[model samples]
Target chain A: MNKYKRYERLAAIVKIFNDNPNTLINLEYFMNLFGIAKSTASEDIDILKDVIEKFNFGKLITVPGAGGGIKYLSISNIDSYRSFVKEMCEKLKDASRIIPGGFLYTADLIYSPSVVSKIGEILSYPFQEKNIDAVVTVETKGIPIAMMCARALNVPLVIIRKDSRVTEGSFVSINYVSGSQRHIRSMSLSRRSLKKGSKVLLIDDFMKAGGTIRGMMELMEEFDAEVVGAGVMISTQKPEEKLVNNYISIFVLKNMDEEKNIIDIEISDWIMGE
Target chain B: MNKYKRYERLAAIVKIFNDNPNTLINLEYFMNLFGIAKSTASEDIDILKDVIEKFNFGKLITVPGAGGGIKYLSISNIDSYRSFVKEMCEKLKDASRIIPGGFLYTADLIYSPSVVSKIGEILSYPFQEKNIDAVVTVETKGIPIAMMCARALNVPLVIIRKDSRVTEGSFVSINYVSGSQRHIRSMSLSRRSLKKGSKVLLIDDFMKAGGTIRGMMELMEEFDAEVVGAGVMISTQKPEEKLVNNYISIFVLKNMDEEKNIIDIEISDWIMGE
Candidate 1:
């Protein structure tokens, strides 16, 4: 192939892997798609890997030997992650974001594609190595973040809805107490959404009493699935005793003085440590 | 500074633009980030644009004069899109996907990031040149597709909830009849979800009677926003007169024979024409 054609192939490879992160792409698939020899395919993979590493764009993992191919993992550098968390902290400090019930408004941030995509990349880092079958989240606010993580992990996203619709057919619904409000609420998942004995990662926009995450864990039990990990974008420090213990948070909301319009938020130790 | 460094920069730029399509990235931002001169930045963008065009990846628009920079527009080639739609049609042809109410099971497809992301890209193509401020969808089933469209458009996603939540603060609610079922349903949007006078794009997984999209339009009216366009992953042909016209669909479900366990689907004319 000519030099320009090689460049074009490299660009196409980057896009294909980037679009399907953490999913293995066998050598045969590329060879068939580009009609290239094995050696040329290997060279193309090498060039892509080098570019990813040198730029800290993400990680490109090549598995050698039989049954091995290449996989792209979505991860951002520590500096970028820290700066992103700090910027999020600053955004949450806005007085207008503080609602009547002391809940910080996050719709704007969570719904922004650029913001959630970055957050998803950072949050999916630790779980990338795990054999996760699906990324799960409760319906409503957590969908975008979970979608991003699912994209990063190259897995299906299973959303637990607040109510079961007729269109969903059969679903398993479970009742759990709201961690913060201490009220019983129901969440349901379409029976077809998950498979038995699958490894699942739970992601959410916030963690209060951890009731929601705990509820999700109980719901997963019905499907006979294992909860490998759980992560949230924000968590409250007030709830020193969380319902679910092993979880990661990107930001810790230390305090909010409604009257004084003062809010304190900082990057979580886990992220800062990175 | 070096050939390898240039490749690294090129890869980073492609990823950045891909992650945040249809958004502007100022030349100065890249120059400052790389500590490169204006001429070098221009050359870098030119190379990236050439690769995208040569590979049929997407479009890179360079805006001249002040208050302008470069923007990446997501548009897949027609052949790839037709093949993708055909694959989806094959998948939907499974007899099991046909539920009791003649509704096709789509939770599996819509929740899959790869599927939804590709659908979002194809759906966003026509609206790329339009000035769209946000992508809106009725919550639960449509969130993922809307999220993808919002990502492609580089805009925020606004989800309309079936019921208002306290966490959303205040919201505007509207009632509309289900186009097919002829049942009254209500959907609400958070007061702060979209800015007034914003131009919005609507997206959903399926369009039966077009009632939901019409309801969304009515809901958007409460916010003083305009609906620029609407797109769906699948639309049924039985609905000869749609409640909402001027919408694009990826696939047309021509027929569903339950007894014979067969489904006839074709790529949308809009997609095939491209």
Candidate 2:
């Protein structure tokens, strides 16, 4: 095998880290692959550490001792995330996006892979250090965003179905009132979806009265799982208080006038570090 | 600003390409970002090209014209993809994954980020050159796989909801038969989800008679979109005649004796280039 150059090794290392984010990798593996010694591997990692920091491409965390290795945590600077949210707010402000039921049409934004992946990265950043075992969401709209968040955090995604399906085997179902609609709805999750006492982060595409997320939290109780954090793409400002506390929303919908065809949305104060 | 070393620039390029796969990024953008000359950027690309090929990460294509730039197309070697599918088959052959009513419980595998992302990459590889405008899938199980496929193809994801909802504004709904259960069901897509005359790739997690995928194909007709291709993670073998044709399935379920607790699954022959 031909020996690889430092730049070539560096390029390959970046790609590997990018491919498997939040995954622990042993230096010996790279040492063997690149035919390099421990000293060279350490130097390459040091250079990569500086490069990631300079570009705000997240962090490369190294642990010492046995059963220890390096892992990549994908986090972006506040400004870039803020700018992305601002662009989303601008797109959402379009009056044409309003539906008949006073709801904003956000499917376009949430469904786009490029857009939602960034949303996922931003939403999952805060909970990266929370030791989350899984990311949870309800069926339908939240699945994409939640999936991306799960991908970013390097965790499994557990989706709670709106209605019980026969295909999922044994499941746990619960009925909760839809906060905005005021109708009791049932949600279900397979018994095998989570292990007991697994720490999870909840994610959703949109939130209004916080009923859905609260329902998810309650559903977590059935599995004896803990909800470490909750995140939504957008939440209305009318309900200053939500059913659950300590949740994050990327955008706050302050007002949407149906007749006037106007919408006032902004990046959430929490995201802006206010 | 401090001058970046050649290796540092190579590392940054790999990270950028990984972040925005299939995106046409201009060389001027890199030059501006790194304060490097055109010749230096060319040398870096040459090195990255060699590194990516050696690592089997993917391809970095450079277009040489005013409207042309460089884009990353994520494609793995056939052996790697075949091995991934083989591993999936091994996990799936476990009798415990069988559920009542003869359905396989695949939520855990389909919902996994790492596993599903690879499935997405493999599924989207063939369609990459087709200029697919979006990846389409029905809601629930297929969303994660479809979303990752869209990510890999660098296109938007359009999810067809099983039931029409008020939040999506105007939508076109269609009723179709579920091939496996032979039950009539309705699927809907928002009017604004796809542009007219766009080319789309249909993806799903599993198919028996392929009724759901056929339903998606019919729904695509309403928007005047062409179905360029279709892919599924797994398809049953007994249904030799499927509702849809010209689709790719990564795995073929040869037999599943529910009473005997046996599942014989294998990587699809096409993937192995049989």
Candidate 3:
């Protein structure tokens, strides 16, 4: 085996940790990879802990005992993330983003990988330490944001299909009323997609009255899944009351006047205070 | 400005590159970030190039001259990825994955972040140098994989909805036949999601006769977008002639013996040869 220098080992370690976020890695793995002594590997980790903290990249947690090792938890700096969200708000304020209906054309923003990846990191931040087993979302628009959140939390994404398909095998489905449109729709999840008693975080791209999210919470009940948290990328303000009482949003859609070609949106108060 | 040691800088650089795959990074940004001279930054990049290749992490390209910078492309080692796909095949053959109607239940594997992240890298590797402007996929099952591919390519993802929603604004809709079910269905995409004349890569979770992909190709024509390439995770053996002539699949399903609980599956020869 070829021996690696100190700097080379450090660089490789960072890459490995970043790739496998929230995964517990044994020091012996690195020792074996670089053909280094246990002491040297430990020293490298110590330096990494400092570098990660200093840069506000994330947190490096060390678990004690033979079965435990180290994990890199993604936690972006609040100030910088707030600024990023502010920049997005400015972009969303453009009058050209208004569609014919009362909706804002946000497909471009929500579907961008770089943009949603950061949104995922921010949305998953509050639940990172909650030991979330999975991230769940109803099919159609919310899948991308939910996938990114799942990626950040290092968990499997369980997508609830709007309509059941034969290819999903045996599945549990539920029907709920759409808060905004007041229409009933059914959503289903494959039996194997989620585990019983698993803790899950609910994610969506937008929420008008939180009917879909409430529907998801009910669907999770059939699988004996515990809904640990719920997050949405954007939420409308007019309803004042949502079907679900417990959920947070990144941006609050205060107003959208299609005729005036104006949109009033801002980051949520909870996120700003963070 | 705070000064960083050579080892610290190396570790941080790796994290940055890993976080922003396929994004161009100016050397001056690093110089300003570390309060280091351009020559020092150049030396750091040289060492990174050697380290990246030595470890088979990915490729680092230095774009020479003005208006150019360095970019990190996500390219997994072919041998390692082949083995990884082989491992997946083993798990898929467990007999329990078979659902009724001769369909194999694969949600558990495809929804996995770690698994699909690798799958995304392998699928996008072929078209990384193709200057893909976007990764396009139909909604429901393929979003996660496509999002990861878009992330790997540093491009936006454009999802085609099986049914157009009012919130999508003005969209182009098309009808096509479902290859396996022999049913006609319609898919739509927002006009703003993709730019005209943009080059796009198509991705899907599974393909039977490639009808959906072919329909996507037709839809792309409406937007004047170029379909540079198409890829799927799994393709069936029967109906060897696909609806679309130009597309690739990672795994080929030769036979599925539901009664005997046997699944004959393996990585595609094209990928194995790579």
Candidate 4:
């Protein structure tokens, strides 16, 4: 192939790895797809690694020997995380977003593919070192973010539904007292959705009193799966007593004065190195 | 600042555009972020377009004059679509996927990020030219694929829930006869989820009688929205009389012989240029 064609192949390989992050792609697959030799494929990957490093994009790991190939890890640097949180905090500060009962309207932001995918990258970073079999979340608002995290981690997303459906066959449902309202709420997972002894990372959109995450943990226990970690996009400051501990959050909602139409928010101290 | 740094910047630019497909990104933002001159930013986009074209990755459009910048279109070549469909059909043919009701268990495949996202790309390609304001789908199984198409189209995903919740404020519910069993089923969308007079693209996981898509179209009519197009990942061939027409599907399920433990499936003829 000519020099330009080689450049095209390099670009294509980068996209394939990016699309399937954390998944191994054998060198032979690429060589056969592009009609190139093993050495040429290796050279292309080397160029990709150099560019990714200089840009601080992410890590490209090359497993040696048999049963190994190239894998892309979607880990963003601390600066990138800080910038993302800061920008999101600014967007959330809009007075109009404060609906009745002080709940910030964030459906638009969470559904935006670019924003949610970036949030997923930041939230998935700390848990990447752990052996996660699936990324789990409750139904409705958290699906997009959890889906992105699952994509980044190269794992399946298991959604815990508020109500079980006939289409899902048999499901295991559990009820727990919500931390905020102290009301009994139930969450269920399809019996076949998760495997016993598998490790799961729990994710959510907001963490007020950690009621939902706590409920999800209990549900995971019923499946005999280990809760490896939990993360949320935002957590309110007033909820001093959280139902769950050791959860990571990107932003902290300090206060929301509905009467005065003012909201106080900041990027989480975790990203600030505080 | 340097040659290597320029290469890194190019890679980052490509990723940013790829992540936020079909959204206009102003050049000034790039210039300020990279601390580069206007000419340098323009030159970087030129290089990206060249690489993308050689690989047939997608198109990078540059708008001129005021309110102009650059945008990326994530349209993969037809060959990529065929390969994706071919591989997924093989995965679906496993005998174990057949459930008690003869319904194929595809929750795992639909939730797999890499596979779903590729399906999203292929499905979103035809609707990219339309004036689509939102990508809509019914709850649970269709969320992941619909989210991907919404991402590709750079629109918010408005999910129609099977049941209403107080958390969503007000909702508009509708009942329709599901084509497969001719059973009356109801679906609802949050009142605030969609805007009046907006264009929508409908997406789903499976189509047995096209009842669900037709129901969605009726629901969209209530919201004063337009249904520009509909697409599904799989559709059964036995449903000779579909409830709706003019929809795209990636795969066709020819037959499922439960007694003989055999399955017949193929990539849709639409993808084969038939």
Candidate 5:
């Protein structure tokens, strides 16, 4: 091989690792492949892992076992939700993620797999101890964590859509506050989709004012189903103000918008390690 | 005992099994917990497996040894990508999911660990053979798959926001056709994100006119980065129309639009055993 370029060597290393998802690779092989030292191969993978993570493909697990190698497990963070919310609180301390309408787009907070997994563990904590009829959540973002929690608890999910489609069959309507300042709002879910009297674990993406959860509660009532428990990806408000209590998820920092529409941010109770 | 509900017993069973992660539950204890015949306890678990799988929860596997009762692992159907995608395609076939826009707003599709896992598998395919410096994807819906894929490929994701935010430093601009047949549209990524000459693998939620991939390609050019591969969760147009040829992911359906507005769904060429 007339001197291989940096790109060629990088490609060769990736190919070797890709052939085995969880298999280990040694520096000896890469050194032979690229005629480079172990330091170069190590440097290349380090740079590559950083770039790939930014793409959201996954994280690289570097193992130092007897047969050490890189193992990839699609994890968010270890107990991602917990650590993520913790990270969010720090971001909140910067007070930037605040969206208009007094809501925090801690959607990034939802992205942490470790946090998501931990929250899944927490929400499922109660349900895993019960025979859950099904997991219920509104359409859209909440589906991810809801699905995870529901899976952990071993339940079916009944996702309530905001707009009922023709195929969904007869619809039931419910009223509750939605988006910004808890304005009264209404949405629809097909009655045919939910089984009557089935226990439902209500879920949503976020609860700033807690209106959507209240709305889902009403939707559950319309279907004559019981609200067994509720889980959310994040909650930036107080639990007492809402109809539900002690329902769990992650919380970064809480901030309030005051005069001139300025906001101050701080971490919520969950990520304080409580 | 005052007779706990089926959920109560199921929860107990799950807790006992899960506390061990992969431990087996004995039949003698099953008979004691439900106070029912060994056959009845066995039947209940069989039903629960179907229910749990829907949530991407682990399965209640049976072992045939004297100590075997039910062995539960934390593994969801999503533990592997190929099988998970197959499961979602089966769910999409339901007539109830058909809707307007030729778009499938599969909230379940997004959350199903198995589905996402399969999506991860498909997206990671091309990049597996190549050294990927990063995983790049637009935000909102595509985040999960991007995140999961990043997780699998041991990479970090750099998000391309639809609108530029305050934190984004320096920027690269690009344009492409939109799914709605809209003429060349622009999307941006933070300049601080991708380094020069880094190899990027683009991913997105759905592919229609292939504008997003095209846009990403243009962005890669702007950054002087090499485009390794591109993947879509669902490709709605004819494969030939895909601007990026070196790609792999699912082929949802051909076209569901104007003139015809008919729906035709196909599993990704990969999951189809291609």
Candidate 6:
């Protein structure tokens, strides 16, 4: 093939891995697509994986064995992504503007590409093979990660609203507990937002008591959708806080103090040392 | 190119379009990447656009002129996607589960991916080019859309909490007056969450009187982060009540009543027909 063809070949391989991160694929498909020998296709896949991994895109894992397939995790090359996230968190911690007992410049967390990549990686573990029809979360903050999972899985995102307005009329609501807020604010969803029997992945920015997630679960059940997995950007390693299984978290915030400017944050145990 | 190579090329072009939606590009990037001239690159891009648009992945808008480039807009592609979202809203509208006035199946709006996709498309418009540092939302539900937008923009999601807890230590808070929710909530964010001079894309699931988003802006000020743009999933077209600027809403629930089984929904004008 000519140079243009080679570029096209490499680009196509990268796209496939990106679209189907961490999903198993066989050599036959590659052979058919590239019209290359099994050996050539394998080499192409290898080259694509190496370059993508070099860029900190922790996607496209090749499996070795019978019935092996490639899995796209949508993660960054581990160290780069983690370091990027860690840097962001540290910056937030240092910025006195983030007052204690106040809204943690959490909004910043949602927009940082590096941070989102890491969080997406943590979330992929559970939803990798399961039939995830949609990703669900409360709006505003959760939209970022939810969207990531949806793209990775090629699904859609469902949002839950906290207030009832004429715009999202005729909905199902649950009066459970709130997690960080710790108040009895009501959460609502339009009656027809989620399809019945479709499996869903739940995601959020942070999890403290898991009350909001539970409320979401209750609301999700009202639509008859199954909760396939759950994930959060950060989760507190506290007690009585089991929200969902097969979930992953990127980091765990440590002892934090607003006045003295003391806070300890580290990668979550679930993600670190993996 | 081989069959696989062809598909991979298509995927790369699609992914590029996905990242730079509604934008234009020159053939140089592809030409250089593929070691081909503009002629071949243009042909491949055109082919890529046609095939993908057939599937409603998004439309590729080709711009002409010296600075012309290609852009992608995620629109209706999959039949199931649209129907699924509409059905989601319908499910929440079901009568078996009803809440008080002014709120129906709010959860459905927040959780539906199809609906959220529309929301992402709208919200992404304002921050498509700027160096967006983060996507911010008050914790809980906002996480979902924040996730979606972050993924689309390849950013991280940061969440501010309503209340500070023992674990999170000190937090800065602002009183956000909510006319729709009808109460002012003390929203808080951690000191370590944001950075100075950072551009933030603020998002929330619902916009009624705009208290929550406004509160977030106030918090952003405390940290000196630039409020680059703000968007909402649903904006109540209440006359003269503007909560967010440069905003977009997926659908408008014009009418909703719990006992009357009356609910009206329509696509938001901000994004549709654009």
Q: What's the count of clashing pairs in each model shown?
A: 0, 0, 0, 0, 48, 120
Q: Residue A145: error of model 1 in Å? A: 0.6
Question: What does DockQ give for each predicted structure?
Answer: 0.71, 0.85, 0.83, 0.49, 0.04, 0.21
Each prediction's fraction of true contacts recovered: 0.74, 0.90, 0.84, 0.44, 0.04, 0.40
The DockQ-derived docking category for candidate 4 is acceptable
lDDT of 2: 0.88
lDDT of 3 by residue, A101-163 (tens): 677788888988889988998889889889999999988788888988888888999988888
Q: Decide which is better by DockQ, 3 or 6.
A: 3
| TM-score of candidate 2 relative to the true fold | 0.98
Off by over 4 Å in 2: none
Alpha-carbon lDDT, every model:
0.86, 0.88, 0.89, 0.84, 0.60, 0.64
* DockQ class, candidate 6: incorrect
TM match of model 1 to true structure? 0.95
Residues B154-220 of candidate 6: C-alpha lDDT, one tens digit per residue = 5556777776442344568888777665786788876656666788889877676677787888899
Please tell me what DockQ candidate 6 reaches: 0.21
Q: Once model 3 is optimally superposed onto the true structure by TM-score, how far is the C-alpha of residue A262 displaced, in angstroms?
A: 1.7
Candidate 6 chain B has its poorest 10 consecutive residues by lDDT at B1-10
For model 2, how does the per-residue alpha-carbon lDDT over B109-212 read when each residue is reduced to its tens digit?
98999999999999998888889999999988999999999999889999888997636778899999998788999998878888999999999999899999
Worst 10 residues of 2 chain A by lDDT: A76-85
Candidate 5, superposed: residue stretches over 4 Å from native: A1-108, A133-144, A154-175, A179-198, A222-224, A237-240, A243-246, A252-274, B1-110, B128-144, B154-177, B180-201, B211-227, B237-239, B243-246, B252-274
Per-residue lDDT tens digits of candidate 1, residues B45-140? 998888998777878998887989999987845655777877887898787887766878888899998999988888888898898999998887
Residue A194 of model 6: what lDDT? Answer: 70
Q: After superposition, how far is residue A150 of candidate 6 from its true place, in Å?
A: 6.4
**Docking outcome class, model 3:** high
lDDT of 5 at B122: 58
